[model samples]
Target: MANFTLKVTRLGFCLLQSLSPRIAGKVAFRLFCVTPSSKPKGEKAKRAHAAGVAKLADAERFRLRLSGGGLAHAYRLNGGALGRRGRYLVTHGWGSSSAYMADLATTLAATGAEVIAVDFPGHGCAAGRALHMGMAVKAIAAAEARFGAFDAAIGHSFGGAALIVAAAGLLPGVPAVLPQKLVLIGSPSEMHWLFKGFGKLIGLGWPAQQVFENEVRRVTGRRVEEFDASRTAGAIQRPVLIVHAEDDKEVSADHARRYAAAGDEVRLHWANGFGHRRIVAAQPVLDTITSFLGEVISDKDAEIIPLFDLPARRMSL
Candidate 1:
């Protein structure tokens, strides 16, 4: 009877999820837990595997040394050409470096868009001890000084949240650098829920979730509720493309829906079975981004830089 009752409860929860995805997402985020791997021996191998997977393109790489900030960062720029009107600045997620977005950058470049991919502080070759949204925004500003204003900004996971914070001017004196179009991939709308889910993944109990929230509040000096993308969506007047995978076990797809619900300018694209990381590399995802940027270029305000014109490697197929 106990097992049967559990099964019935699960079925009911599933039915509720079908009926109300947002509420169901909150529930699932609270309940679902992940356990860390016990095999310490595989850590090095895992890092090596991750590095291998990150190797995507052979684009020209350059370093940007920020003046006065005492910081130096690496960036990968592809499809350099004269009279290019627009740029695509890509920010990678937590635990990922600029190399992770190589394929997407390559695809965007191939579609006649100059792509600027940067490594956030404390990641990749960037010289920093810790990563913060302020530093990331500074990096963007520095990049803008060198590469000029971007036509569109695409961020993945944590980078997506940082993108919002950057555009909202949450960091004082940091001017809101608004892009004509914003693309958020696998970004959660609520930081509290996301941190709670992260706690569960690391075996943190309910108490830990509360502590995590408190810490976040103390650090940011703002209530977690204030960061809801749904509430702040109206502040962003530019068109937004929110992409998420239906099978994503990291960040729920409902977060995308919340972003879409926040404003009519937002469009939601739901992909299936690509999981979180693979969704970024998917061809369909690339095609959609290319099409969006192409439209922006057609507006006559933006310039397009074709990859074939670059003096780099020649395309042989």
Candidate 2:
């Protein structure tokens, strides 16, 4: 049924393209921005989602009203240790909620770091049907205003892209909420690649794609290709730790390579077999992130901290 629906949807777009490319492009772009449902499907899936939510039961839940008239739900976990390090922000990917990030948030919170995880407009408990980077940025800005600047931010996939863009202060009117450090796991380097991928998914050819790009520019006030997180990372002087699995099929490892070449302070960690989503909860990835955040290097003590037994390599450039 899902396959049939998808085929029918594709055929509808094809017919629309034949009739009016402009209208087809507009509809395609709107459909492209539609947020996926975060609700659990079956009984087993419901149990798993309930478990994820249960993990955040101890957290102080709150909501921030976004400038775009949407509300972002957030969960704040206070540090367990007496010597609190600092506040940290954790943002999940598209089609994900703050509950999904509970593992990482709880881990960070356990080690004396106050962690806040947020659900962007349409995801999790936040109410909305559509989401874009602009809305994501506004959500982050609202969080900053409510809780103040975060010392570090860890983002997975789309959340990472939004984090980089918000930190870079690329979009006008929205003030930058740059953290002291960053962790981008399985993130895309630019927006055009995503747009191109979406084009392929919807069977949109060059004419429709051109119209889509024009619509993108109208919405973002910038060319689709201009939203490069790698370029933004280089421009904004901050230490960034990029964790990417060599086996990440959803997002190419080439994106991580692009980020590694972007700046001297950027460090890339290669994880094996974890793919995109699992890498978020993988022990080695978590260790690497925490070490990156906690490590203090003096001239005499400059050496790589020994992490987990996982086959991982770190590149400092």
Candidate 3:
């Protein structure tokens, strides 16, 4: 019976591979998959876990109404008295809520940076449909309104792409709240390739891939062929850090390489072992970010305030 079950599983995978090469590639990508490191285990661990869970639940329950876009909700974590320290705005990926980033945010805040974790539309406390990149952009703007301009912005996956658009001065009519520095975690330079690879993984064929690409273009107002982060990376004019896991099963490391090729201002850090989402929680990645912040903060002569110095308060919102 065990042998039969193994045979069936192998056959199933083979069938999937044959159905879509992109899906097959996704499977190949999954071989490098790394789950997020679990929280510590102990009495203190239990208490901490419980507290974190409770805070997440409470944040989810709190709802806020958006003026033009309709009603939505968000999780607002006020990092205790960073005082005059700088602020960091964090955005999570698709199918994930702000809760997933709670660990990362807490860690960064502990480093004397004010961290605000935002829930994109339709994912966390925010209302709406899933994968709505436009709404996600708007939600980001709204969050900025509440928290003021961020010194640095970090985004994972889809959020990374949105951040790129925001930085490129693409979102017209929307208030430009570009961060002094930007970090793209597990972000792909080519949207078409990423989507195609993703669709293939889920057994999508040419027709499905094309349709999805069309919808993406319609929503973003950018064609798949024209969507190149390398070109846009130069326009950012801010120091950009591109961090991706070598073993990432989602966005490949090649994406990071392409982004690096685009400009000299971009910095690429490849962390091993950690997969897409897990990279956020990985200590090494956190350390890199912390170190980068330290260097940027120390370099006073630098035109761009190295994401560490807290900006003066503006009376007008």
Candidate 4:
């Protein structure tokens, strides 16, 4: 039924494109920006959600008002009288909440580093139902204001693009701080690819596609292609670790190559078999990220010590 409904919707968009390209593009653009709800429904799901929250009950929960006027939810871990090595800011991808990133954030906190995982606009516990890269940048700036400068920022998928854009400090009035290092897991390198792909998915014609692109430019004050992470790689000039699986069905591994090619310090880790979502929580990937961030686990911290071997090797693009 869902597949059939999607096909009918695509057909409707195609007809609308024929009648009025501008209107069709506007509607499609709005649909494209809408994020799926992360709130759990039903008794079993709610119970699972509660369990996940309880796992991080020790975290210091907080919120920040973003420039977009929405409350950005975030939580701080390992912040109470612990010897800190560094501070890390973490962000989740589209259709996901900070709960999904709790594993990585908790592990980082276990290393005695202060870790704060942010729920971006329209995601997790944050307010709103729509999100764009611009809004995401504001969320990062808001978190930085509340938490101060971070030693590193880690993002998965959509979150990765937000981190790179915020680090670039290209957007006006955002005043985002660039982190010392970055880790991008299963992230896209270009907004152009995502926009064009969405257009094709909804059966938008050339005229409709142009209108959609114009809407993006008007909202962001830049072309969709300009949102490329590879371009930001040159501007930030910071150490970057790109963990991508070759078998990823969502964002292609080529996106990882784009960043590696553009930056001298970018290292690409081919974490095969984990696909897109699981790659974010895989033990090997987590270990590689910790090593990149200069984290050294002591004998006393058995919980933070990694059990998986680091998987780092060169792959032919």
Candidate 5:
């Protein structure tokens, strides 16, 4: 680990260790779901502003009422014909909102198909304080109902895991949330690993880990131990794009490797310098995503676009 990360981890453990396990769990959970109120300063703010402009350009902002409770905010960036290329869905990861995904959605909208970006429950305009795996699934289902069927879906980080979960039908009443073309940017491949990491960070130990696993099992009705991205990816018979930044400290590129195989069914792209969050804003990364989406919208009936056909993206050192 980097010295800074190690120091932060140590400090976090020291502070959480002073609390009871229950209180520690609560603190950890709160930390996990809370969204930041401020926009990044300097260059980050500039990039974010550019992204927001993309969202506002010929965009129709709307809201959907989720079955679980509150309203889910969305922006539909106008594309070509109403459903010519099929509706495209773009979603941000945990603790993020549709605004963060606006640039990609805007770029994809250039293909002449409406690109809809959503704010999941507990994030953005959606109501909630804590987000469970089940809630993400519900958010997707609600989006599908409100925005129409998605021919292509792009999810960042936790949003990617939620797509797979929705696809697996791990939860009841949700159909296989399949999109003809799917992209996962900086997404983790295993749920158990995330749970264990959270528990370890909060000094919850094995006891807390077990409680988390039990909660996941209770919600999804599946073995938490078997929660692997490869397993879920195997179940979906569609084109998938997986992008992982080599320097990402939050989620390693190895997670992307696990989801990638030796076929056109799944393609993996490596990015650098962008870290976990900025990868979504990098020019090369943006080109890579647009190249993939362009192909999907290029065709009629929304057939699978071969990954090999995409133009090369020059990675920086």
Candidate 6:
């Protein structure tokens, strides 16, 4: 069934690509922007979501609505402490349910900090056919309003890009939702990388690609180039911890390096074997990230520098 679905989807894309770039671009924008729900990923993923929620102490679950009938499934775990212990928001990658990130969210909940997680539109129980950066940014703001400001925001893949956008004041509300501490795992530095790769995979020409990006600009009010994390990373003074496995197959590990290069105290955690998705659920990765989160929360004087692991055979740049 999965193979058949893949083949059919491919055939549909081929047919779409055969059309003029303008028409194809508009069609592609709608198809790609729409998110399929999180129902398809199977039992293990479902169990993970349940387990993550079970792990949360005093979990508060709710639904949030956005423009165009988009919805977000949100979860909140209050800080173990009585008073204000700070709140942390967790957002997962594209095509990923918030359940996929429940592990980290629950783990953060173990600390005294309030932990929050949300399934973006078209992910998990959120009702939408697709998701785009603009919607993701809106979701972040919505989460902020419901839970108050975030002390830190942890995002994986697309979530990281949204965080950068929120921090950079690139969204609708100037100063959208800013987290004092930021964590980005396996994040893409630029949308050009994603669009270019998708274009090649589907045999989309430059004209189609440009048209698609133009459509994105028209819908989101932001150009593709503006999504680059490195472009605005330098100005964000908040301490950042970027973890990317050397073997990450999706977003390049260099994204971590580039983010660090953009400056403002980025600590890169270079894992050796864990790929993009696994990096998020890895125990060591979680420990490293939570440690950084704690440091920023507890130590006013904490400082950091660039970090990465190079192949033993290759000389460091």
lDDT tens digits, residue span 205-253, model 6:
6777788778767867778887888867777777778888889988888
Error of 1 at 201 (Å): 7.3
Per-residue CA lDDT of model 3 for 1-317, tens digit only, reads 26676566456556765676555544433331222224434686456556555655533233544435644455545444435567777888866656666676776777767777776656655655544444566667776777677778888987787787766756446565688778888987866676665555444455435555666455556566656776787777778899998889878888888888878889999987999877877889888877776534323444444443433422111
Which rank order by lDDT, best down to worst?
Answer: 2, 4, 6, 5, 3, 1
Measured by lDDT, the strongest candidate is 2
Per-candidate total of colliding backbone pairs:
1, 1, 2, 0, 2, 6
lDDT of 3 at 43: 88
Candidate 6 residues lying further than 4 Å off, grouped into runs, are: 1-19, 40-47, 56-58, 67-69, 79-82, 173-175, 297-317
TM-score for candidate 2, residues paired by index: 0.88
Q: Which candidate is the best by TM-score?
A: 2
Q: Which stretches of candidate 5 lie above 4 Å from their native place?
A: 1-54, 79-83, 262-264, 296-317
| Per-residue alpha-carbon lDDT of candidate 2 for residues 157-199, written as tens digits (9 for 90 to 100) | 9999999999998777889998878999999999898888788
Task: Write the residue-wise lDDT of candidate 1 on 1-317 in tens digits.
Answer: 26676566567555765566445444544333221222222676456435533564455566665533635354545445444545788888766666667677767766666778877766666655555444666676667777777778888887787777766766555566677788888887867676654554444445444554555344445566666765565577778888889799888888888898988888888877888888778899988877666645323334543434422322221
Candidate 2 lDDT? 0.83
For candidate 5, lDDT tens digit of each residue in 211-231? 545666665567667668766
After superposing all C-alphas onto the true structure, candidate 6 shows an RMSD in angstroms of: 8.2
Ranking by TM-score: 2, 4, 6, 5, 3, 1
Off by over 4 Å in 1: 1-58, 64-72, 79-81, 197-223, 297-317
RMSD of each: 10.5, 6.3, 7.5, 7.6, 7.2, 8.2
**What's the alpha carbon RMSD for model 4?**
7.6
In terms of TM-score, which candidate is stronger, 2 or 4?
2
TM per candidate: 0.69, 0.88, 0.71, 0.87, 0.78, 0.84
lDDT of 4: 0.82
Q: Put down candidate 4 lDDT per residue, 117-156, tens digits, no spaces.
A: 9998787788889888888888899999987878789999
